[model samples]
Target: MSPDTRIHRARVLALSLGGLMALAVAVYMTLGAVGSWSFVLSYRGEKLLTILLVAWAVPVSTVLFHVISRNQILTPSIMGFDALFMLIQTLAVFLIGAATVTQWPPVLVFLGELTAMVAFSTLLFRWLFGRIAQSLELLLLVGIIFGVLFRSVAGLLQRLIDPGEFLVLQDRLFASFSGADPQVLAMSAALVAAASLWAIWRLPAIDAMILGRDGALAVGVPHRRMTAEVFLIVTLLVAAATALVGPITFFGLLVANLAYRLLPGAPLRLTLPLAGLLGALLLVGAQVVLERVLGFTGTVGMVIEFLGGLLFILLLIERAR
Candidate 1:
């Protein structure tokens, strides 16, 4: 289909996503009044914000990542982002006592994480792409391998830490989405906004990049620089989400594949926006179903991951045939 047709279809998809979001908001409002409006609203509001942030952060990064790499299966999480995040937290506890690490203000911790992720991504891309001409599949394989290395290293370090420190590490790793500092939320929103604006400026280039290396280079696009910039952005976005809500694997894989399948006729202009909206809708809808219908089971992420993994497999098989 032509770009115009894709854009029109994307507009239609956007309308659908907007409708679902509106529905979710209405449901929340009705349920919000069902209990103590003050207490329940305050508590649920934090969760809603986390869901929105993760929703925006993950799919955008993943989609742009695929565009840069020219591969649908490549995701930001596959690049050792979550593993690096966990490694940092584990190393912090191991280096400093658990109390000291835990007592360090969250803002400082956030900054430290942001810095480390930027550095790691810089090194990762510089090395990975700097080598001789490589395929997107090769990049994906390397990323997955590096992610495993990071996870193994982090796990081994965790074993060496004292049991008490391990307890603290576990808390940092698996906390509920119940509380988030308002200040941190504001900072995170600002970062996402800035990155998004940059993304908008680079959108045309991204569309070009999706055509692969030679195609982009032929069109006067600097593929290497764009890849590096996108890698940095993806890492930053993933780190922000991890810092916000611990690592929830497969969320991006699920949503991005769904968006692609459902919106083949949608261009980047429409696909990116619709994908973000669908992500928010899925997460918020799941939160509502889990809390209200399921009586607050602590396995929303696990359930979503399970379903998403299955979806990923089905999509792969469909693509193969």
Candidate 2:
């Protein structure tokens, strides 16, 4: 296909995804409303904002992570990022107790969580990528090991935690759209915006990096530096989203891979935006179905994880073939 034709197709796909996302948002905001328009909009607006921010952050982070790792199946969540976040939250509750943690300002908690996540990512990447010069396979293996270790520690702490505190910790661990604090949502929006700007500026480097390390280097891209920069941005985006909504293990993988399939030959500029839009569409659409059709019987996060897990296994089987 001609380059222009590919670009035109990508544009059409993006518009379609964006239009669907807008429709979902409208339906979510307006459907089944019983109160004053102003009150309903103000209340639903916060939840909608949280969903959009998370949708934008998760898929963008996942795509950048896949580019840096050069693996479609790899995600930050798979690399122990979400496990580490859960461990951090669990440890906080274990050490400080749930009451105090809950009493702490949401902004303070968000900053602390973000700081811990970024610090952890920096240390892990430095050791794996910088000091050892690990291959991608080895990096993934080590990440799996770390993920197991983090989960084990979290489990042990939860076992010892007071049951009430454990309940609080459990609540924080699951992804919840309705439970998002407005203050945390505001902070997350700022962080995601900044990360998006950084990503926009690095689109050329990202496209080059998609060609793999040696290929990117051959094409005059600073492979190591670009990888580090991309990892940093991914860490920030993941941290912000995870902090706001809790851990979402497979949602990013699902959205990123779907975006890849939907825009097969598109460049990073097109693919990234499409991925974000698709993420929003999936999330908001799922929430709409859960609330409107299912009568909120279960959380949207669980539904996403269920479907994403199936997709993850299918991708693995496909990869093996």
Clashing pairs in 2: none
Where is model 2 poorest over a 10-residue stretch in terms of lDDT? 133-142
Query: How well does candidate 2 match the true structure in TM-score terms?
Result: 0.95
Write candidate 2's Cα lDDT for 1-321 as tens digits: 577987888889878887888899999999999979998999899999999999999999999888888788888987788998889999999999999989998888889889988898888888888879656566678878988999999999999999989999988888988867778888899999999999899889888998887899999999888988998999999999998989888999999999888778678888888888899999999999999999999888898899999999999999999
lDDT for each residue of candidate 1 in 1-321, tens digit (9 for 90 to 100):
787777777778788789989899668646736667787677677778877888898888888887876667667878887888889999989888798997888788877887887787777666666774445556667778988998999999999999988998987786245577777777887888888888888888878887788898999989878877777777778878877777877888888878888878455777778778988998888877877788876656777778878877877887799
**TM-scores for all candidates?**
0.89, 0.95
For residue 208, model 1's alpha carbon misses the true position, in angstroms, by 0.9
Clashing pairs in 1: none
Question: Which parts of model 1 are misplaced by more than 4 Å?
Answer: 1-5, 29-40, 131-141, 162-167, 319-321
| Predicted structure 1: clash tally | 0
